[model samples]
Target: GAEADKGSLGPDKIGGGAALADGVGGGSALGGGSSASSLALEALVRGVRDDVLALHLDVLNHFQAAQEAQTRAMEEMQSRQEAMASEVASLRRQLSAALQQRDEFRWL
Candidate 1:
């Protein structure tokens, strides 16, 4: 819009805040500030973006580590549950054998 409205002589093309008079001049774009200020703003934005990215990466790493720890804990719990089930089954078999022996003794 700036280039279209101001023609080829807009201040934007000259990097000046105002137009260069009757000669073809590019006008300032949407009242934008000087190029130096824009560059500074860009640098500031870039720095902030970098900081956010770094923090995001850190969070991802922490989440990944936590997930891995939880997975290990779940696996350990599952193993313990299996062991307990096996022990219970062994105990049941022993109880059944004992009862059988007692019945034989009674018959004798």
Candidate 2:
């Protein structure tokens, strides 16, 4: 009686041994059996793949937006720096001209 019970408890006796099955070819307890299990697994994989691809695309879009914003900021900074340089040059030229006029007046 004990041996009979043990045999019944073996992997093969349960779920058509589907749990112990190695791969797609392996049997399953599902009503449609091994093929159904394989199809279900494939569908799950495909769904995950699609979701991951969508997430990757969203990340890329965000990255591109950030890059564009940074570029604009850099360009604005560069333009401001150029304007400041021009102002400084103009101030220096005015100072030089004023100094030359003072020297001429001292000689007079």
Candidate 3:
């Protein structure tokens, strides 16, 4: 019954026990014997490293895109501010000229 229970545990239930029995456990769970487990561990590590590198690159790309968008927004805002400043200056000059004309006519 103990053997039957062990068999019934399955790979997922026993946390990769079947993989260990199959000589591909990466030597982390089962005892080390040959270079095959080492190779498997190396392959797993490489795969994880590649995935992390890909994620890092993706994040960098997103950050660069966001930075570019922010730069464009700032430039647009600066242009609008300059345009508003120019309009305000023109209005002030027109008001000053109109006041001068009014004063001259009143004195006449």
- What alpha-carbon RMSD in Å does predicted model 3 have with respect to the real structure? 16.0
Backbone clashes in model 2, listed as residue pairs: none
C-alpha-based local distance difference test score of model 2: 0.62
Off by over 4 Å in 2: 1-34
User: Which ranking of candidates, highest TM-score first?
Assistant: 3, 1, 2
CA lDDT, every prediction?
Answer: 0.60, 0.62, 0.64
Stretches of candidate 1 off by over 4 Å are: 1-34
Model 1: how far is 25 from its true place, Å? 25
lDDT of 3 by residue, 1-108 (tens): 453233332335434423334433455444564477676775675566556655665565566666767999999999999999999999999999999999999999
What does candidate 2 score in Cα RMSD to the true structure? Answer: 19.6
Please provide, for model 2 over 1-108, each residue's C-alpha lDDT reduced to its tens digit, 9 standing for 90 to 100: 453233232233334333324343323323335466567875565566556655665565566666767999999999999999999999999999999999999999
Ten-residue stretch with the least lDDT total in model 2: 4-13
* Clashes by residue pair, model 1: 9-24, 9-25, 9-26, 10-25, 10-26, 10-27, 11-26, 11-27, 12-27
- Alpha carbon lDDT at 53, candidate 1: 55
lDDT of 1 by residue, 1-108 (tens): 443332333224434322212121222332355466665665565566556655665565566666767999999999999999999999999999999999999999
